[model samples]
Every structure is written in C-alpha cells, then in structure tokens.
Target: MPRVEFGMKTESGEEFTINGELTDDELLTITNFVQSAEKLLECRLVQCGNFLPKKITWNQVSGFDICEVNEIDFEALFACLHLSRPFILQKEPWSYNSVSGILGRVFSHHSEVKRELKGLRKIYSDGALSYYFDISIQEKSIFDESRFLSWLNSYQYHRDQDKSVLYDELKSSFSENGAHHIMLIRLHGKLQAIEQLTHLCKVIIKSSAKQS
Candidate 1:
C-alpha cells in the first residue's frame, strides 16, 4: 500500500506524526473526530506539508510562497457536503442587559472561535490542505483596527432594544441565495482581520454539527 504522512497535536500540546496508507477507516475516524464538539476545542493538524500541494521556494531575496483557493469552487463544494444552515460566531458579547450566554446559544452553540480546531484535521488528513484550501491564520487581523467598533455598537444597540427577532436578522442574513459569511473574531480584546476567517467558520460548522 502507498504510504501517506501527516502530523497532529493533542489536547496536551504534544505533537506526533503518522505514516500510513490513507484507508477508509482512518478517513471516517478523522471526519467523525473533527465533527465532534468535545474534540473540536484542542486537537489540531500538524506537519501537514505532505498533504498539501507542492510549492517551489524562492531562492532569491525577493521570493515568496503562494497558496490560493478559488472562493466560488470552495463554496460550491462546501454546499455540496453540507445539509444545514450556516451561522455567525460573535466573539464579543451582544448585550449586558440580557442574560449571559443566551445570545451566544441563540447565535452559535460556542461563544469562542479557534483556528486550530478539530474540523481542520481533514485538510491534512485528506490532502485538502495543499490542493483545496489554505489552513493559515492572519497574524494581525484587519478588523482589529477597522470596522469592529462600528459593528460592535450596532450589535449592542440591537440587543439593548431586547428585540431578539431583529437581533437574529442582524446577525446572519439567512437569504437562500447567500453563499458565505464574513465573520468577526475579537481576539486580544479586539476584532482581528477578516482574512482566513473561513477556516474558523469551517471548524465551527463541524463542531456545531456534532451538537445537532
């Protein structure tokens, strides 16, 4: 059997590598683990170079690496694999006036968003990391400086009004034709950039599925 190599991190932060054939049983185990809410919090993929596509490193001083995924094709594939509605994960609190955690449950089952969640295991386990999607997070999110405060104020205002119906609509535009979501994650007490948020969204989707 042909062998494939991959890496992963556990809840204890220890790392290990696996070298074996990509069998169906392994694939099913990985997918099920990633989609489990309990496991989604800490497990992560590591040493994923073998699963991603090949890239040439620039020898010159001005060289850089490139890995890109087409949004249209990715969304199409995502919809094809999914049978549920997409949601938004708000990092900041919605309103101090209402009961805590209620809004979060109303919006997403989990209030926190993480990059190296279990759902991402598939990217490395199935070779989608290199060919289908990128698994990196922006060091500095643009939302940290721009658009976050404004969005936060709007969210607070809607929530303060005690209009759960209006707040839900403001949270996610549930249009049938809508393709994807632009999520805002507030890390270090602020919203980070919008880039690569798709990865977090994917993790949340998988984790949430486990709940339902």
Candidate 2:
C-alpha cells in the first residue's frame, strides 16, 4: 500500500508524526483525526513539513503521535479579523468564547445594538480599518427596489451636493474610540445586491475561521 508521512507542530511547540495511505479514504481519515485532536487539545495544528505520501512502513498509522497542544487566544484572533480585508475574508481564529460573544450581541435587543454601535464608533476612533459593502444584482424585487431607492436618496443627500458631506458622514458615523463600522452601501441600487453581499461575507468568515 502507498504510504505517506506528514509532520505538524502544535500550538504549544510540540512536534508530532502523522502517517497515512495515499488514498481518498485515508486522506479523509487523516483529516478527521487531526480535527478531532485539535478540538480535544483546544489548539491549532500547523503543518511542519511537506506532505510526503509515498514513503510509509507497515508499523506506521494515519494519526499523530506525541501531539502537543496549547491554549488559544481568541480575542487577538477576532481583532485580527477586522484588520486586513473584509470581515468575511479576514483570517482570524474562532473559538467558542468568540462565537458566543458574537451570537449574543447579534441576537440582543435594541439596547445591545446601541452598545455595539457605540463600540463600533470607538473602534473607528482608534483608527481601525473599516469595510464598505457594495451590492450588485442581476434581477430586482420589492425588497431591492425599496432598499436601493432609500440608499440612493441617502447617498445623494450626503454626496451629490458636496463630496465633503460624504466624508463628514463617514467620520461622524464611525466616531468613538475603538468603534469601527462595516458600512453596507447600495452599489447597483438593487436589492438583489444582497447576493453579492452574502457571498463576500461568507468568503471572509470562512477564511477567518480557517486561519484562526
């Protein structure tokens, strides 16, 4: 049987061995093993050596040996998510703590919304990066019709007469120490724009999860 050997380093700086066979079934098994270990140890496993899939011994197995694990820093990971690209594409680590916090705030009432708004303002005030969501659509519907018109009106009111108004609005809206806002703006003035927005958000979130 074709055999493979891979090396990885745990978050705690422990090196380990991972061996498997060069087959689809074996690859899936190896990935599952690594994921399980990551969950159990509460740490990420990074590949330490190139994937070598042609050299294996009968005694080798498709799993890690001497796996080392370490604690995770979720806060730092979350902060990093907003620093580089759109929120969805940012490579940030995800942990139960961070996920819980996000869910709590998102599902909270108006009071929580206000609190988050304030927090966003603070983030912007601290000169954090911001993202503007632009939408595009192939077809239109009632929702798109209404939201797009509203956004257009708002944009015109803020920018048509003077560009400075737009800048002023951005500054005012994103004010407060540590307050950062991800602005969702109508791009093609269509509700179908949501499709693109959704796609972008997914991409960012997925990337962040993997990297974190």
lDDT of each: 0.28, 0.29
The list of candidate 1 runs beyond 4 A from truth reads: 1-53, 56-60, 67-72, 75-88, 91-212
TM-score per candidate, in order?
0.19, 0.15
Q: Which candidate is the best by TM-score?
A: 1
Please give, for residues 1-212, the per-residue lDDT of candidate 1 as tens digits: 22334444667887765333323443333333224322222212111112222342333664323223112333332232121111112342221111122222333422222233223322212222233332222342222222223333334323333433322342333221110121111221111111122333333334434433
In candidate 1, clashing pairs total: 5
Q: What digit string (tens of lDDT, one per residue) describes model 2 on residues 34-99? A: 343233323221121111122212223532111122232334323322221122221323222222
Positional deviation of residue 182's Cα in model 1 after best superposition, in angstroms: 15
Residue 128 local lDDT, model 1: 27
Q: How well does candidate 1 match the true structure in TM-score terms? A: 0.19
Angstrom error at residue 107, model 1: 23
